[model samples]
Target: MALRETDPAEVGGYRIEDRLGSGGMGVVYLARSASGRRLAVKVVHAQYADDDEFRTRFRREVAAARQVSGAFTAPVVDADADASRPWMATLYIPGEDLGTHVRRHGPLPPPQLRELAAGLAEAIRDIHRAGMVHRDLKPANVMLAEDGPRVIDFGISRATELAAADVLTQTGRVMGTPPFMSPEQFSSPQDVGPAADVFSLGSVVAYAATGHGPFDSPSPYETAVRVVDGDAELDGVPPELLPFVQFCLEKHPKSRPSPDELLHLLREGELPDPRPAAAPAPAADAPRAPRARRRRRLLLASALGALLLTAATALTVLAVDSEPAPSAGDLPAGWQEWHKKSKDPNVDEDPIDADGPFSRCAATGRSLVCAGDDVMATRFALADGSNTWARPIDDTPDELGSGDLGTVIAARGGRAYVYGADDRTEGDANPSRYTVQALDADTGKVIWKTVTGDGQEATEPNSEQGYSVAVPEGVVAVYGAKGQQYALLDADTGEVRWKRPLPDPDSRICLLRSAAGNAYLVCQKWTDDNVTGTSFTQLDPADGRPRWTVTVAKDQDVVGQADGRLVVLNTTGTRRTITLINAASHIVTTVRMSEPQPESATPTLLNGTLYVTFPSGSVRAVAPDSGRRLWESNSTVESPGLPIASASHLYLASPSGRLAALNVRTGAVEATLQGRDDGGTADSSAPGAPPTLVGDALYVPYGIRSVYTVDMHTLRA
Candidate 1:
């Protein structure tokens, strides 16, 4: 494939070398990164740039690709759905597509066929675990890499739970290759699920094995009709694989085996017999000759599957391991990998709904609490993922774009502070009454509840679009009245300690944050008429008096304060400067970052080191004082959350439930905990909840669905 004159020379800093191919949505180009790593970048077609619906679908495609990470899939490296010309970059897999290969080299041999089956199964498994379904799976979409097959192209893929609610399908649009589509896809496109991919896998395997699809016909309409009403033409399929292929090609989605079940069958060497069970009995008088021959064929198939599966052993461990050995140090006394939905046992209904979905968590001692729009504040043991109790603060659904989302703010002294809202009126335009509840961490009992509002009338706390809350010295702080007011409440009693209006209530934005047990009100305004810069006001916890006020540039964002110095990030032009302002002396020290950061990059200051995580899955640890790059490493987890640090490792979680542990000193990934398949949609655009690190135990929340715990020792690099 060669690049055309119309193609761009570069995309997102990746140098485009050659064109890989083109599709209805975009063109994929072979590119190279700054570090000389090869990549495949898909640039959306220009004609569809202005199409709002098309952009939405493209965003969904990037989300799906980022959610799925495994050996049998091309992991997403970078993407920008909001760009003028949206594009995504994935690791380059140099191999011909299955369709091209079969056409040039004819049908694959038994060994390669066996490998393809298992690889596709693994790829589908990973996608489903991320709560997505690759609605379009065909020969042209699968790459035959040297190690195994890699699933590519997520243009038409979508989350399973969104199937029924998909807007595109409402117009009766059917979007997949007819021969590879499942019956349910044709009969009920909105209800298709992971089983649909299994059906496509079966068709793909049949094509690879015999150079033709089982449901092939002259017209796509005829082929689709055959797929829905006719039996598969498995006449040419290898005898050893006939049973498995037939099982996958079942007309009913429910009858088709799941990806896990297919893998299990291959592993157990007990594929169903293709021969009819009503065959004349031969055991009584014929020495069971037919049964013996069938057993031999099954054994041969199993042997082939096992031999090909050897290449995927590492991937299997990374994807489906129930438990793993300790890698770096000793784990907690009884710690093990465990997962549980945060739903209350008494509540059989669905979790609360929200426009943007994510989770928040806090941990203290041996207890962890997580809350989200999907579920209420749920308490779990740090040693295991078992929840002792679950409490919902507000059952009413949050309005879209209302900033009414709730979450666990902090956990301290055997109590968890939860920030939530109670909707007093049905669909009222006025904002809901915000409430903060202090619950006993061990028993999930409400200790105290208080209602307060910051004069600023702000949005959700910890939201990227809004400001964040801080729990300092056993006191909880919040803003209200559009960021014009501030309040502090006692952690144990949930009683308002002090409330006050800010000196400048008309500031553009005001953040209630704290550092080193001291409460601070940060406000900033940079407008055409009034550029007030930014002000940091330290407030007295006892009397609501401003102890001191520090002013900096309007663009400087406070990351944290350390050793009586306020640390802020200043992005001016191409330089990312970390400025440290001494609280007492008012001395400022500026350290310019070595590399430019993306707009989506988030900086976290932990234990004297400033760690910056990007949307591309890259993490960099820098010396706060000197701006020296300590180390940099890229993990498989995409759209990672804020990182939590231990003595030796930095742990991060992805919205799809994947967790990665990087060595803090060397920046090498030391261990990875496999994600779980919760059979629900994952919002990849939202950052995941940071993991709670307590001793050698780690508790993590998977999007808005469930919480899991793992022993740090059980993770291997």
Candidate 2:
């Protein structure tokens, strides 16, 4: 039943001023606390007064809200969960939800989207720190106030403790709005934690960007089905935000990015706003348009000049030449000394050499991992640069039509996982195929190989067609266009122990293992384009079976896990927001950044500090938890890789072959390494890899050829 304006004049010493809103669960009223602060108070429906289960859940929500209240969320002022009609109150935010804003003013501009992403990421980080998860996140719940986006509504939130309790709700009974449900939510809820919130953030961002959810279905049932079975409809999503959104909407939740990763992507300007709706085609013979022709010529010349200037600057940096190696006496303790010649023969003719030089190297236990043009792999070593053994892989050609060699390498469980795709023709229906190869970390022997589903392989490159792999809980989790698949293998023999297929092809998955020895599968759904919704499921690793499920947003990115809560980065790409979801209580809290930073920068979180690196080599560190900029520096040259951090410094590598190290605590440039000038040209046509750090060494691959190793201690000493 709908609530009437005169329903209640007072409740729990707080006089109700006016009716705010009404929903199936309860009615919200505008109220004032004893301290004179305005608040939004929600009272449960009379019919549910006898539902002990729901009352308990509501209590859990109240607890969660109190735990995670902060800059980005409406703080919980008071609550009477045990009252005849359970009631809860939160600070009243005087602003419009994103839905109302978009409805009233179409889609947000590009700058708004960037700001939204940054703000949302910080908010999510805060909630995660407090150990809560907001299971139900949507545009209607986000307030676009003057200060920033403020996330409200914690009616269906959960904490880690509540999530672990015995099932109080029926199985397969949907608990959230279908339009914003994650795939895992349909299959499992008890296990759904912070990652589930990320899926919701992605959906919310999609709705903000193009004024439509990633999944817009005819009916709630249909939406749920589509969310659990189809792809994100990303047609109207901006190209710049596409990759990041896609990563967030991966069918496998584990593969979804964390708030930090999404912040980085946003800062890097990787997510572009949707191009203005294509202008109507001109008439075939609409006069010989001389003015239009002149404008086009002028624009082309300006663009060319800018490109040339950029190229010239990059070349100038590369021409600085190599410097003599620093002596061992200048290094720190436990930092061994070593050096070696490039195993890559034909250095002069190498395609990577044409771009510039290799800047750094990394020693991972007994492996010396290096980066080269379009290639990165591991070589046998032992804490030093000395090669226990060397294994070489063919590099991709520097041509538009050439195949791309995998660039990211992660070594775990005695095997190295290489992420790459075989490039294809432009018009080819399937232009790229993502593959994961497991090689013996010690011998570089191919242990096993797995390709994405046939449907993914059949899709075109520009379409949803790639996979990401991560090792979680002793299992090789592979996320692809079709869904998440895993191969539990023997750590030593590489023999497959078990395999399981996820529920949806378009679901983004993230693997979260709780302290209770339970494994949760977080999955978010997507359409062909936008991130419409998210869902989470818990699976018993012993035998993959559905547990409980929770729904988050239409679009969101899982940022990180802390104290049992999942941090999520929510954005429409044009307007960023961060939300925290309590896996146990199903409560959500959101906060937005004051303004959007440039998209050219990527964000990173270290010891509570958020660092964003821009394409122009500028790096800014912000305190998302506190909503303040810790430091900003533009002195270092930018690179394609993510920022690498050590105990004392933050390092960034430029494609032009320079490694800049900054003091971590002070954000000061401590040293600069003018890497080897191999005279190699960069593959401007392809995506670049991020730098890798292992032990005291930094490994960087630039322009396509060669790998360089720089001693952090030596540089500092």
Candidate 3:
């Protein structure tokens, strides 16, 4: 592309000589460093230069890229993410990205394919070793340098999702080019690891060999479906190269070779083929089995970034790390850790929920109250690993009943407040009835229960719904997602103090919180025309009256409560903007993010600061008031649970069956303890249940239904 007259002559001390390319996020300019070295300088789009989220993201990309070390990857020469235009300069190797190279000519030869594969594998290994994943590894991001294939983009993290949402033309269309994506990237984008890049490399090598994507289609959607559900067509691929490509495309990330492993496999130039099975002629009376099973394509995710295989609710085992809500004091003496299964002991994990975190746990100062699979509610000792009670709450008449105890509303006083619901209808999609119950902390005895009178209106079965953290001198629970209702009950007696109903039952309300005994929530609504937005409402829990409301953009989250304000993170395209709504006047204030954030979940807000932990085990703390990042710590744990914090430490659990403690002040990993290796699936549990701090002791839960506690005093030492 030729440089336009409007192009800047210089940026960040580099002299811009020409235009390399323009992407949704920014423009790549050919520049020269002071040392007379040629460089590829990527300048952020003017529109995004002022965007806090993109800027933060760019900073993260630079940080991550600087960590990668290898010959087959572009090296970061210099970067100024904090510059006016936020530009990054890399050693500009004179070569075309793989896509242009192949399109301009034809597919590479077999030897070149081997080189490309090996080079990319080496690059990915460098990235993985840096504790990062090159999620956006596509043809355009791979530079075919003279030495080898140089992987370009390394920081293609969450921001890539936003970048992928750009429309190609006026009529409105997705810009995703899906031929090279991995299936699980589509199926479970949150759980990607080093193996995902291997899948992309396979696709790139296949395209380099065959002049087309393994799952190419006329349309991106069809291409996505093919990548997710269809077969990889490597017809023209050489026999020797087929094994490497096939192994890289495994459906399960764990099955793919690591960087070291990939090097070993390609060392001899091929993978060993499985022993030939007896081939039988098609049965005259029976249909043939499904075509030879191909590798599961790992689909790449975008904020709608390239192609996101529509959310397939099929995979149920998301890590929902279970632990007591409000833990009391230090770890008990003479404590020995115990482990159990979160999966149903009777029927087995649902095929969909392979890592079925079927169980949830709570501590009421007496015992760990749990519910999952076949068990309704069970109490295990808080002091020792002994069963206090096991109450079966699953066999209820509510057909669509949670099949376990319902959402653990909250633990307070000496009881566990539970939001219980189930579908009485035969095939209803949502819960047909809803109610609240107070369970004994030690005995698992029901202290009190109440079925909301409006239980006839069935609500969609959403395990993510019905959660409430508002406790103005009592535990509050939100019942029905769309039909928003708030119940204020006594923490000790489970007696209903008041019920606050919204304008409609279908008004989606979330983020129930209490600040200084004041109740607040964000209500969401969707129109038929696909219009979506949210209203931040502050309610008087003492009187059940709304004090004020502030409406914000769609797909936003109330990340935390700040002094005199509420921190709201709004997503517009690929950018996540932070807005602070004044508690008194409902005025809006925007906070510029200090750096880019990866896909974050289970955000914890404390004392004017917001904390978010990622599936990659990276945790960040940002001050909503100043938009300054306090710290960002990377951990070895994968798919960490929701994050919770204390005065000086932050705590979280992982599906890898471990609990971790990080220093809040320095983002330093303080301590880690292995929970249980029940062979639980990473995708089996949700990231909602965070590690809990009761008094000075920290309780962490494992996906396979194990709980471990850490003594804060011991941890600090």
Candidate 4:
């Protein structure tokens, strides 16, 4: 039953203007304070207020809410949690709840998804920092206001002391809505922490994108069971968001992403706003001298002034018009094509051009390099697509070989690198031998041949037999059993200028810079048990000598470098934390999230923004400097390969061979291309390979032997 509106004269010293809404817990009334400030007052149900225990809980909730409220949250205006009827008031937020919005409109667009994720992550981070936890984070608890998202209703929230009290009371009682609850909340509520919120966030995001929870069931019991034991049905959920959601919903609480981490993941591509230094707290019991009294009055005035300022800012934001979509002609020119190798006969070949299989191709300055199951190193003219060279590099018999010969193939700087294993020999007992060949990018002529040796030799300590090479600024950095080794080489002549070998054989070398006459290497050594012990060192190209070294945990991966600081992600496959190390000062600042994201992907840093991908395929743009998430996405595409981003678009290649382009600024899908079939596997053969971008095109490959070069301008159309 709905609560009737009460006249302003009867309720406290405030004027009740209208009935806002009613829920099981309370009836919310729109009211005005003495200064005419709008507020939403929630008067508890009469029956609940009559219960002493419920009243105590309400009071605790109010305290907790006040302790953690911030810009991303609805701040408490006034509350009488100890009153006969127990009522609370918060700054009234004018907006639709995420649940209602999704139900009214189908699904939130990618831009809105990013905004929602960033806002919620910040809210949760603030709550966690205050030692409070919002265990009931759901779509209904989020308000999508014009300015930003506002998290509301901490009725079921728990703090240090209240958490213990609620645990005792909820020993046998269900404490949360089943569909949105984390596994820990149902299995062991007392043990639940910030990770519980991450699980709920995943559900909220799922609902926002598809109007259904990850584990939607016919009954509450079934839903709980599914959440605890079943795999989430990801039918309509974007692939990119899947990995993130999966990480959030990990059965282990410690594996979930923290709120700060989530924020970083969401805001992957923008500079973070600076966080104001925390104000010093006043002494608890200072003497009420004249100065103290005056200070109190000043504080009150300042708070009121801040409120007015916020109100004015809100009005200004509301006055702005909504943005419109770009027209068709606004898009760039050029035909876009995507190639997917398929096993299915019906779709294995391109319907338009059956002149053999659609080959994987990339364009150079004047030529196109292509490869396929029956071909390798085929060069074509970029102007007219006329063939200049076609060479068969793979000579192994098809039946005994792994289809296309080479993997980890790349072409750049007028050179091509290809990796392929030698054919099985008669009665051979050793693992396959691999080979690396450098070819002239234009003429398809072999420049240098390096036998990678047998897999046994490749596994030898300090052996450089089977290393993957990367040329950053003309310097070739190689990773092999012999550890991280690099040689400064002339880009055109392939002449070695200087060479150096890393100290640790098991060290994973992440090449950061090979330009500006210096190269930076992040070397991470893993213990036998898989714990990371990392260190950063700089080397001069002129004379390979270590400049300085700083120790770090190996579990972290280097994300970016800025302002002489290194940003690293502390990931444990189940949870993530961000650590910022000032290289010169050797000071480390660790920012832990309220929720743990276990399956968060490696962070991509572009410009000042860091893009983090989750196992759920959700991508988040964050600012490492300010520890803030800028954006998030709902239309994530799942691919084993990492998404590549330019200044304008984020490019993702689907396993089924579709290439999707999203606006980098807004996370909106600008264009999509269903790839031509060329008999490729549905899954990726090389999971760690990032999509390569050259000029205005992107090069990507699936399990099939063929690769593809897609026009970026056409993709955005």
Candidate 5:
């Protein structure tokens, strides 16, 4: 392309040779540096340079590009965002953009397709690790170089931490090409994250494979609707790559695999079949494959001179480095603290979710099992934080309904127990059938499953509610859907040993707590939000019979049991009280608190002390025996989970993965571990999973699909 008269003669003192391209924001010109090195200098247009918002975005783009350095990404050589024209220069490569190549040379062959997929996967993975999301990843932004594909053009890229404040994402404004944009980009632009880029990659790969996007349409509006509706057309894509491409086109962001997972698929070369058909022998006239080239070396003197020149010109330039993301050695495999994505290798954790997503994990000894809206039942080794196995979510989307999906109840007796329900529409009303499943602790295989009759549960199981109890020995007691019948099933064979109707039909169970081999139900009947009657019932573990039933005060709810006594707390009224009832003697003693406890505080009884943690990160230790306030400490954690304690200290985690430890006696801040920012916003509605303690190891789940393990002995403030 020849340079037009209107094109600038030079940019940032670099001689402009030819006009490479022009986009909505600016024009990219082929330029030559003083040392005769080729560079691509992009200069903002006059209209955009005058727009303050556009200049701010350009400055952000320059900063983001400087942070990313990888073999598959163009290296930013120099940038002056404060200049009059706001120009940036990058190392120029001799190649055509992927869209142009595919249009000129036809669909890429299988060999080249595999190479391109791997390169792009690595490129995006690196970009995400640098805390940025390339919002625009269409074929036009990828260059088909001789070595591999190189991702270019960060004009629309954004730092994930600042996504919430992005002004361009305001309503009625859309970014990225319609054919390549993700569903979330159009529906919830403010919530678009790294998964959006993965969706665009799928579209780009589909275009490279078949010379057309999956949601191709003449009208941009129609293409956007097709993407949001999950209407993809992959008729021309090769069968070998069909499933891989489809995996990336999932309607839900969490359902799509990560870039690391995509790279694994490409490396395995096993999309149903490992062996691809041999390519037809190329014609003799065809050009031979280009030999692999080594990285260009820079002389020490020249590098020093460039650094000095950068200082003189007040420009930002970074040396290209080939460092990759963290590897196994960098992870907390043994004793060191480590963090990783909560993913399984064998199972495709594409969940069919009905309820809002959040992780619930249960741990026993050295085994940890977790399930959530996005993850199925996955077991991780508590010693090294390695995923052992995972049970996939139900793949039958046609029958998916509004009920529980992969909710881990408890892990005990060498097994993990989970429950889910399927909604069946038999008439005007939708009834749900619940199923309880048990999986082997060592292997992820399902041990047994028991389904109940078609009826919705009287109350849904949630963080604040309970429906099932996992007995440590070999029995699981579950309440039927109608909440009338209680069944005791054999954990080993899934056989119902006994089914009996629950007593006291007029009362509703408010809290179900099990401790010291005894299950206690606090039943209360309310009239217009006012409690009319309240009673406590202790159920027999052997035959599902109530061993004892006693009436109690309406305001007290059973929280935990300690020293053969149930610790009850008055959680509702302005005048808070603690009551301790002897399980055998039936003698109750009540003590009034000095101050009323906050309604949002979570209480957990450990070592005969009741510890309550507020949402403001203030914790208080109360003596149930005498209502004495031991101590209260205002820690730095916000939105803290339920506090768990050892003999000396109490530990809790925030939704952001921040781990804080407090001394038990004095309630002093002991130690803290800063949370990791996984480049995604936290879901405020999702319940935060409490930290699981196995000996000295603490496993904390936070942010977006990430879990980290830290040693209690090695934690630092």
Candidate 6:
């Protein structure tokens, strides 16, 4: 394959070298990073890139690739769905597909055939153990890399608890190659469990051993039918392995042996003597990097990261490499290291989920309460960092996005309130029976919890996404709705001050805060995956009574309250505008943009101004009412999280924990602090959550389970 004139020269910073192949979905290209790391970059076809569903599947594919990590699999290196032409990169293994090899070289001898079966079986086992099924495992998807058969292409893979994640397989539309597809895939694609891959592996091994498919048909339709009710044509398969292949190609999915069983069958007496660990199968004319260069690159893994500095984590793999172990000498004034009683898993639940998502602690007057990857919730004395109490969450967090999505933990008045769910002991199946708990932050004890109506949707906290909780004078007021239910709960006492039915099932109730006041609840509706409209409902928590309610256009998103008016951003599509709406008069005015809007910019409103941070590290300030750009600062930090505003300063953090501050009015850099490049676990999501600014201190959390705070007063312009 060669480069075409239409293909872009580069994608997401990786320079395209040559086209590896093109398929129905995208084109795979040989690419190299600035660090000289060879990669297989797949750029989705323009037609599919425009389809939202395709983008989602690609996002899921990146997520699925992160869940797996083994010597047998090609690890995902980088991906950006938000890019104009969405692309993903994985470590490049120079090799040919198993099918391509058999086609050019003919059938494999028994010894190599046995190794192929073992490698493919192991690859399937790794995917299955990750609680996912690689629905499309055909000869074409199996790459005979130098390190063994690396299972590639997870574009159609889905996890086991897929009521929410995957809709493609659940719909049961025909996917994957007809001949290699399992029988169950034809009838119950949604429920085609891990065993489905085993059946495909049998067919693949048979094809490699013989020269043709077990169920060869003139058409895909006939091939699918034969897959359900037909026997295999195993004439050319080696006699010694025919029975095993037949067992794998069973009409019933259950009849097929598991990956482990198949591995045992192939590796047992098939080898006269114990075989040393099988390395990558060497095939003539396979794509190969120079051995000398490859060896040198392996030795320079640590120092090679300087070339990857463009992205805070492209993993820069500064996240993947460990620095010298931190000692007490490196600990802050009173900080000390502590671990949860429960052990940290070898791999995190999700890629973006750091060892601690909200690694930063919330200062509760005298003590600090926090939640993280290893320690579910813990408290320590600010004076000495002595562990007051520590609580470890479930080994595998109940919610997969628990860390990626904003996590809420607020501590005040000597009582800490953490967001979580409390099952009614009647099984966790019914969402209606579930209650959102406000636990005592200090001891991990349940202090108060609120039960919603019919449990229509999962409980989202007073955190960023849709809802918020505020403790004014001792009573906590929570604003959020689940299903058709909304509640103003006493977060401390667990009492419902007011409850009412919401308008839409897809609406998210957000409590907007501003310098003026924090008494407004903004509910935004989503229809067909699009934010349709927003309604502002002002209320009093003391009486749980409504003050007034107003509705705005479908495209508007309430950023915050400004000068006694609701400041919203109209996100209709590619073009976005800021809209200011009067909560009382219901008058709407659109603020004109002084500059082009950045793609996927995270916006935060402070006082009467809005600050936008782009992935490229550009910060912009705009007047909320006028939509006028005040100033824009090009930052040195390549990747930054969402910016949070303090009185006169705007603060943002990089993946490496670098913190930057700028003047809210001028958008000029005031101060910058370098962060430690602590090696973090492999994750595909954004670098990490933004650092939290509380009172006069900025707290930066890390994946290695530590928090470093700096005094804002020390930063000088």
Model 4 misplaced stretches (Cα beyond 4 Å): 1-363, 367-410, 418-436, 450-455, 459-466, 472-490, 495-499, 504-521, 525-532, 562-564, 574-576, 581-596, 600-602, 674-680, 683-703, 706-717
> What is candidate 2's lDDT per residue for 1-717, written digit by digit as tens?
344665888888898888888886789999887778898999988866666656776776687778876688888888998998999988899978899999999987867876675667667666767777777778888888788887788776777565543344222233455567666554444456677777788888888888988978654424554565457887777787777667666544555667776787787754333322222233443322111222221222222211111111111010000111133223323446443434542233333322323322333335544433333354624344444333322323222222223233345545565533444345534233544555665676667654543342221111001123233443344434543464443334445556677564433423322222334454545454344566655555555565666677754444443344445543222214445566667566666755454322345544445666655577876655434566777646744345666666788777655778888777888888775556255544222334555555555665544445566777667
TM-score of each: 0.52, 0.45, 0.53, 0.43, 0.51, 0.50
For model 3, how does the per-residue alpha-carbon lDDT over 1-717 read when each residue is reduced to its tens digit?
Answer: 788999999988899999999876689999998889999988878876765656776787687678766887788888988888888888887988989988999988888988888888888877777777777788999898878888886545432223322111001112223567676565445455566788888888888888888888654444655676456899999888887888777655555666666677778664434311312222432222111121121122111112211222211111122244344454645455445433332243222122334335666666666654334455667666576565433334321223323345455556766545433444533234555667786766788876543343322222233234536355565544433566666656656678776554233424454554566665555443122677777777676677888887664555555687767664224324578888878889887777654333335575456776555677778777877889888855666666667777777777655666788789898887665665454334344345556667666665544555566667667
For candidate 3, give the lDDT of residue 158. Answer: 32
Across 217-236, the per-residue lDDT of candidate 1 in tens digits comes to 65442354467645688777
| lDDT per residue as tens, model 4, 1-717 | 234544234355668888877775777888888898989888887766655556666777787788876789998878887777788898899988898899899888767776777787788888888887888888888998899998888777778555542422332123566678776565345445777887788888878878888888654434644676456776676665665566566554555667776666555632134321111222433221112221121222222211112110010000000111123222113324544332211122221111133224444445455554334456544333345565543334222222222222445656655543443445543233444555676776877654434542231111011123334434344424322455544445546566677564333423333212235555545443234576766666566677777777644545556566777665333233567777678688877643333232446665556666643456677666765676777444554245666667887665445667777788777787775466445321223234555556566654443455566676665
Q: What local distance difference test score does each model get?
A: 0.65, 0.54, 0.59, 0.54, 0.64, 0.57
**lDDT winner between candidates 2 and 3:** 3
- Misplaced by over 4 Å in model 2 are 1-363, 370-402, 419-435, 449-466, 479-491, 503-530, 536-550, 562-564, 571-576, 582-587, 685-688
**Residue 224 local lDDT, model 4:** 46
Using TM-score as the measure, name the better of candidate 1 and candidate 5. 1
Which whole-number lDDT from 0 to 100 does residue 81 have in model 4?
70
Residue lDDT tens for model 6, 677-714:
54353232234545555455556654454556666667
Alpha-carbon shift of residue 134 in model 3 (angstroms): 19
**Clash tally for model 3:** 46
Error of 2 at 393 (Å): 7.0
Model 6: clashing residue pairs? 146-280, 351-683, 355-373, 356-373, 416-441, 462-468, 532-554
**Candidate topping lDDT:** 1
lDDT leaderboard ranking: 1, 5, 3, 6, 4, 2
**Candidate order by decreasing TM-score:** 3, 1, 5, 6, 2, 4
Candidate 5 local distance difference test against the native: 0.64
Q: What is the lDDT of residue 42 in candidate 2?
A: 93
